[model samples]
Target: MEILWLSEEDVKGSLSMEGTMEAVEEAFREAGRGTVQMPPKSYLIYKKYDGDLRTMPAYLEEMDATGVKVVNVHPENPGSGLPTVMALVILNSPKTGAPIAVMGGTFLTNMRTGAAGAVAAKYLAKKSSKTVGIVGAGAQGRSQLLGLAEAFDIEAVKVADVSLDRCRALEEESRTFLDATFEISTDIKEVCDADILVTTTPSRKPLVKDDWINEGTHINAIGADAAGKEELDPAILRRAKVVVDDVVQATHSGEVNVPLAEGLIALEDIYATIGEVVAGKVPGRTNEDEITVFDSTGLAIQDVATASRVYRTAVEKGLGIRLPFL
Candidate 1:
């Protein structure tokens, strides 16, 4: 069998954040409704190379979309002129168990993650949130900024990174891409002061301080997609109304992985999943003063939903090259 091959450029041109966000929200609702097939991600952590490889698979029951993603996180890749992260997604016919296509997944991964961030913010963040703060001026960092900007009336953006040069570049890049004013800082605390705080770093240590967070700050923790990788102080999680994409996934793979392992918080500490909130089973942001945290481990349902959308859109638009054999 020969499967259709879609390039990174094609995937980039075919899928968009607005559409992905809408589709992913629906996917989450389906997840809450118990119509999705998603198993916890499996990973191979490489301490020698300072990297990790993850395999994520899911089936969107309603959409009949099934796919698996192989992704890697290597913070040192940039020095070798490679991306810090890379991914590949393979879509298959769920009923037939036949391979349908192999598509570029790097961009798909970033977009779905951003969309998940938006979905979380839509429920957990207060309505009046106007400023967005981003930690880690990298791929996920940029996506989180764009995602939050799309959801809220973001007036300004603040970015912080270990490298001042990266922060400055991110400031300029965001100003151009987002068409908004921005500031670069080396202070994580200053960035955390914004109304909506998003952390997307790969650091194993915490960058944010508990005291720096404001009363109503809504934090989207996107960095800790693997075990031991973290960005926020656990104290913030202790006080905030924590919402995860999936408890089973987050406990072993997301920002709460370390915390859960240490016995700091139990499964009951998770206020609700974004899916439950989206499905109206649980209320989001009960009080204006409530500090809410969305711990995103990057669900596979997101990839399935987004990949299905992109695939359908590409097919309709005649965007990709159709292979001869199948």
Candidate 2:
């Protein structure tokens, strides 16, 4: 048997915002319909290196897509000229449990996550939302903006970060695709004044205060993938309609994890899962004045779905190297 090997470039060449969003959206629907099997992520902490490795496995029954992603988060890797996060996804044939493809998952991770945010905003954010705010100007932040531009007719973009260089770089980079006027600031609250607010920082404490959020705002809480990491104040979650990618996962490591552990909120405070909303089991954004939040912990089903899409495309295009295995 030969396993197809797809590099990051191959994956990037095959992905588009629209295609990824479609794939990821369908995966969420499958999750809502209970047609997917995704175990909570398992972690291996490397305290000595200040990093952690996580394994995510999933099988989408209807789609017959199966994959596992091995990812790592090392915040200090930039100093060594490496990305802060890197991943690899291996797609397998659900029929016989044979590995079909192995592809670089870092870019897939960014794109799928951004697609998840866009899907959440599509259901939760108002249709008239024109302005977007991004709190962390990192890889995830850039991807989120890319997905948002595809989902909404964005008029203005506000970005806040510690480094002026990163902020301006995002603005300049966005000009190639995004026509919106870009504003860069170091003030996180200044970026909060928008129709849609996205917080992607890896902050242990709340960077966005409760009062900073206004009425009718839709927030995509993209950070806090692990325990003890939080970006929004617990109060923000308390009053808003909180939707999670996965309820049990969110309660353990998503944005609500810290708050739940501290007793600031309870599991009952969650409004609904994004999958349910997409599946039409629950309504999204009943009124214009209601605040909404999508707590995303990132799902393996997303990776599996997107990886399958790429693998199919690669095979059709005669791309990727097929190496003999066993």
Candidate 3:
């Protein structure tokens, strides 16, 4: 009954971006084949504060990973000296249903979410893509940028944020992490022309107009994960080859959530889950000129797959504080 305590640093040390990407690819394959056991994520919404808590659980029998993540999205956290999001993961031994570890999940959530974005781009983005645009220069923005770079030979990155300082900070930070040059802009449209576009702001209204997107653009909508949040016009979704991490999750909480709720777009309009493309069940990026949009709601299978990779790494490297209770 040992409970392992893993800090953010330990988790970072235990996981590799490359390894997580491989694991996520497999999860997408299993999910596409309907072999993964993942119920829709359950959420507890609060009306007074306009906050939300989500509990996501998944078991991949084929991959032997099982975990439940409890996360919160409080938009006011930055003003309150906290992050806008926080999470914790409880990893369990699927064989005996024994709890194996409790680890900080903020990093895992961000990295895996970014991994999903990269996975999407791997399938949907044009092979010759090099330039990237990022809307929202926060933590998620950085993750998305790095993830996108992992999949492309990005030569430059264009970024826009409401805060010029944040945008500049992202530019400065990129010097150390990425080889690409960065350009900061106050105008959202300036960033929209990139071959790969990522929207990570938690905007409740559309920010990037539909017309701003040109042909051959691949958008990773990472911001809109709740019912009211939206980053792009529904018309953009209607015209693009819309793919989601999970149809059920996206229908309820992803970028398409509000559009679908309002009858602006039908479920049939969705071409396929990103997993389908990853699994070879569907083709991706068939045409270089087609617009592709990947709606990322952050799948539970990502957590299971990512956590399993982290756990295995921790075991092999002797990375975490293992308690004697087991």
Global lDDT of each candidate: 0.87, 0.95, 0.89
TM-score of 3: 0.97
Model 3: per-residue Cα lDDT over 1-326, one tens digit each: 58888888999998767777888889999998888888998989987987899999999878888989999998878888888888889899899899898888989888898888998999999999999999999989988877877788999899998899999888887777789878898899999999999999889888999889999999999998888889999999999999999898899889999899899999999999998899899999999899999999998889888988888888888888988764
Cα RMSD for candidate 2?
0.6
Q: Write the per-residue lDDT of candidate 1 for residues 234-266, one digit (tens) a residue.
A: 888899999999999888878888887888778
Q: 1 or 3, which is superior by TM-score?
A: 3
lDDT of model 1 at position 45: 85
Ranking by TM-score: 2, 3, 1
lDDT of 2 at 25: 97
Query: Per-residue lDDT tens digits of candidate 2, residues 214-318?
Result: 999999999889999999989999999999999989988899999999999999999999999999999999999999999999999999999999988888888
Where does candidate 2 have its weakest 10-residue lDDT segment?
311-320
- Residue-pair clash count for candidate 2: 0
**TM-score, cand. 1 vs. native:** 0.96
